[model samples]
Target: MTFSVPSPDAIPRPDPSGADAEFWSALRDGELRFERCAACGTLRHPPRPVCAHCGSRATEWVTSAGSGEVWSFTVIHAPTLPAFIDQVPYGAVVVRLDEGVFVVSNLLDCPVDELTVGDRVELVPTRVDDELTLPLFRRA
Candidate 1:
């Protein structure tokens, strides 16, 4: 049997737009920022134009403290991207920020065995390529 692997470019990348653009811009500036609805006091991420809770268009961007708790995770046993083949078994996680927004990121700087729900974590910048900077998490 033979199988083909996916390329590294198939990996997800951030789209620079609206509030999402600010999130990526902040990462390049070495910070983590989140969006909050000015009308309903709801916090959101993956930055959208409207509040998910109250359907309000009044949204504002605020800097997060870069600290959060691991909500859930998946350890990739089979790497889909060719460049990440050697890094199989890496972790992808959903983190609940202290401010109440969940951020999706990869967990790094520690062994996968130690990863667990509720583990305290902090955001760190990861160099994806020459021009890309991604937010990764590590054990706090």
Candidate 2:
């Protein structure tokens, strides 16, 4: 099933800064990236300036396997924004990436009521525009 999302102009866009800029750039290139500490090898998301584990300032972007399980989720029945009104009843999922990090994104192509805590899923990139591509998910 194909999922519907708000157009690039219709939704808020992330303003990538510092290390976060690399994360967003990888998405535009159709790959999902996370940061790994150069010192402790701890992987993290939402990119940070320093490693949470070792407090190291050195980090590197690593490509994800893009497979995970649904750790948690919520089905939105109410429209929080006018742009999302048409997409109400969408599943917002917290995916536990195979690498042991969790990222919050949307789950697509499945009935919201049917989603389970351990459902296997894979990355599905939805190109919002030339500069932005949102990482959505579907059942593996």
How good is model 1 by TM-score?
Answer: 0.80
Backbone clash count for every predicted candidate, in the order shown: 0, 0
lDDT of each: 0.76, 0.85
lDDT of 2 by residue, 5-107 (tens): 7877888788878888888888888899999998899998878889978899998888998999999988887857877777777778899999998998887
TM-score of each: 0.80, 0.93
Q: Candidate 2 clash total?
A: 0
lDDT score of model 1?
0.76
Error of 1 at 69 (Å): 0.9
Query: lDDT tens string, model 1, 23-128?
Result: 8887777778788899988888778888989999988878888899999987777846565565676777899989988877777766777779999999887665
In TM-score terms, which candidate is top?
2
Model 2 CA lDDT for position 44: 89
